[model samples]
Target: MTEFADNVRQAAVAMRALFPATPMQRNAHLSAKYDADIWLKREDLSPVRSYKLRGAFNAMSKRIAENPDQQLFVCASAGNHAQGVAFVCNRLDRKGVIFMPVTTPQQKIDKTKVFGGEHIEVRLVGDYFDDCLRAAQEFCAAEGGQFLPPFDDPDVIEGQATVTMEILDQMPRVPDRIILPVGGGGLSAGARAYLNALNADVHLNFVEPKGGASLTAALEAREPVTLNKVDTFVDGAAVARIGANTFSVLSDTAPQDVLLATEDGVCTTILEMLNIEGIVLEPAGALSIKVLDDLRDEIRGQTVVCVSSGGNFDFERLPEVKERAQRYLGLKKYFILRLPQRPGALKDFLGMLGPDDDIARFEYLKKSARNFGSVLIGIETKSASNFERLFGLMEEAGFVFNDITDDETLVNFVI
Candidate 1:
């Protein structure tokens, strides 16, 4: 363990040649709100806009160290990991082949291309990451290329542990707790290794997207297990299966320490940081910060650190983020209304709305019936209870309505 700590520190020193340590900023807003000294480890500000570079760089460097003649590398990633590998490959002047899913955003593909220049070749393979992973592995084996496991390799883990070294060096005192966002678990695993070796009394909590809690599921089962389904909205942190190597280090974690942040709630946190603090956090990056609310009572008067994992968010998804946040906050909703085919019928329904209620969408879905029509309506309100009051008035006025805000099928198809 001591040797591992020493290695992590050495890795931190090596990282300086690439880029300086990412900032650990004390957030005044969060500190005041929680009555805790809150600091954010801004990995989002790294050269690749994520801590992924640390692991990739370390793994590649170690491989080069083992075989000086080795020059080829391969990886599979939809986002940050690809950029990390690309960045390292460019810096090391090595040839790289990155396999990505067909559905990966073009911005990421272009950015990876820009980072790697002529040294990296990107192949768009499957519709999902698993397919890309298989393809990359097959290609790497056939071409005699060293394959980089994003979070599962020991050298990568050692590289990621450098973040902990930087935190201890940057902080005035050891933090009371460290919160990390977990996906395939490399970052959390690496942090755990170095921090545990230091024998600090700090509490460590791992946050996972509620839709894809690979770590929590592993802990609950006492072994790593693949999730049957995963929500990819929090794309960077949504892993269907925790890496076996990472789970080995994290298996002893208490289930209670694995906090889950909802996809919608993550959108809210992203918006909060963006709007209030002007910090544009990717959904995966916001995971650690999003779950801070759950730890407020315990962390009071204590120092806390949240790892902002990445800032590679696409502005094209901004409207979707805003929509999810609004839905989660109960400020927006959609419903189907049965309206009579008569003049002033729409006016009467509009008249029933409270002063704070605003119609965001109103369209007749169908007018096939002779007596009434199906109207798709979207409403925005100042508060959640406004909908309740509006519904009561709607009921009294003999208006038939179906609240389809929470209906997945209807929302996907109509709203």
Candidate 2:
């Protein structure tokens, strides 16, 4: 085994003192749907409801062992990493200072606090991650405390490799393929290294959010590249830049193995998992499963494993997830309609709706015109074809309407 893989095994052994290994269970629902032997490496079942705790524990354990006098640690994160560090700090009884963006969700902040207890103090430093990271780094330097990175260090990578070790132990045999979600690349890099060392005849596939394809960009360029802008819908995996150390390890992977998932597409997977399997997944957590559709033909009748990376979803985001899923599925649409000033016009329009069709929203965009006025409308229906029928009816009735459901600019400003 490579030195990295050996270190990962050691980390796995050490982790047993804290929590049991996450399950690698064959998923009957997914297997049936795709005609494949599908398994889920359930990292979402970890103590912090994510695989992040492994890296945090591994890194901190190594640091503390190296210098027994070291008691203070610091880190900057908006979500999972913060919770991981907090949990580790509380476990080790070490003092920690966690810096998080002010705009981070209250659910995450509360969870981190709960995990860390009195061992960690959270500082809401800035509105953005970069700003908060800077503050954390400066504090660490000034206070002579160890700085725990989210994914850039070798120890963190080794720690994440433990997940792969557990997967091999839990599975009946080597999987034909392993699907991993990439953020800063710690988990992917670590898992790939260990699996390679074990001589597992497995194909590795990496999934990244389309709006934040840092890993894809880096692999294409043969170096890390900073994205111009990132969509934070998959906040846990929405890294703007791939980590340098992680890119070095992942640099040789074939480009075809990397997949990009859209935010709305991920939402559909989340909803499906929740409604069908009772598996609640955060946006980033659904990356691998969401991309299974893209691999349907290739994975059929083959043993495949997808890392369900986290389950720390906030219920407040459920409405947004449902809306995005509906939009992607074509079950919902937004439109601007020119309504005639004549009485009963609204009633006539309502009458054209199918039995399953429902008006979710209606607003007047213009009211000054005497002959006609513009109305902003949102409608939902049981089937996507219902929109076609609705449009046809409006056309036959001489109604002028513009569908803006897919218009990004207008949707952002109006919807």
Candidate 3:
């Protein structure tokens, strides 16, 4: 084996002191649905509920080994990374400083604290991740502490490569293909490096959230380029820019090998996995699985492994996830309708509804109009065709309405 592969194996062995290898379970539902042998590398089942702990532990351990005098470690993260570093610090009894954006959820902050116990200190920094990162770096430099990057460092990449080693060891045979979810590219880069070093012939595919496709952009540009805006719905994988070190390893990747999953579509997969398989997946965790439908033809009858990256989903977001999934499936809609201001108008509108159509929201926006009033209405139904039938009846009855489900600005303000 190549030196890199040997190092990755060593890292994996060292990791046993902290936690056992994460499960590599074959998902029967996915296998039957795709007509292929499908397995999941359940990183979401890790101690911190993410693969992040591997990288953090490896990097910190190597750094301290290189210099035993080093005691202070610093990092900036609003989610998994912070928890990973905290867990490691607590386990090692090392001092750590964690910086998170001021807007981070209380649950995340609490989890980080719980993992670190007395070994780490949590600081609420700026309002944005970039700002928080800057603060962490400045503080680390000032205090002479070791700053742990989320995904860009060589040590961290080496640490994450352990996942690839564990997969090859646990699987009955080498998979025909491996699907990995990309964020800043740590996991993908590490896996790619390990496979290349081992001379493995596994076909690798990458999936990224459509709103924050940094890896796709980097591959296309031949370098890392920051996105102008990123949707935070898939918060775990929504990186504005791919890491520079990671891009070096992933630079030769073909654009065709990278797939994009819509945020709403990921929500659908999240709900499906939760309700059907009793599995909870955060938006980022569901990315690789969400792209399975797109690769059905290529992966049919072949063995495949998908990395479910994290399961730090807050139950508070379940309603929003359900709403987005329903909208993506065309089973829910919001519209503005102009109704005549007369007696029995409400009864007439209710009469136009199909048996499956239920009014989820109804509010008059302009009740003082003399002839007509503008009403904002949300409807839920069993099928998309129900909307068509309901709209047809509304039009025949002389109702004026505009579907606002796809209107981003209006929905943000009113919905």
Candidate number achieving the greatest lDDT relative to the actual structure? 3
lDDT of 3: 0.95
Candidate with better TM-score, 2 vs 3: 3
Candidate 2 residues lying further than 4 Å off, grouped into runs, are: none
**Per-residue alpha-carbon lDDT of model 1 for 1-415, expressed as tens digits?**
5999988888888889999999999999999989999999999999999999999999999999999999999999999999999999999999999999999999999999998999999999999888999999999889999999999888999999898888889999999899999999999999888878988787899999999998988888888899999999999999999999999999989888999999999999999999999999999999999888999899999999999999999999999999899999999999999999999999999998999999999999898589999999999999999998999999999999999988878898987
Instruction: Candidate 3: list runs displaced more than 4 Å.
Output: 367-369
In order of appearance, the predictions have TM-scores of: 0.98, 0.98, 0.99
1 or 3: which has the higher lDDT? 3
Residue pairs with colliding backbones in model 2 are: none
lDDT by residue (tens digit), candidate 3, 355-411: 888999998898546799999999999999999899999999999999999998998
How does each model score on lDDT? 0.93, 0.94, 0.95
Measured with C-alpha atoms, the lDDT of residue 394 in candidate 3 is: 93
Residue 198's lDDT within candidate 1 is: 86
Q: Mark the regions of model 1 whose C-alpha exceeds 4 Å error after superposition.
A: none
Candidate 1: global Cα-lDDT?
0.93
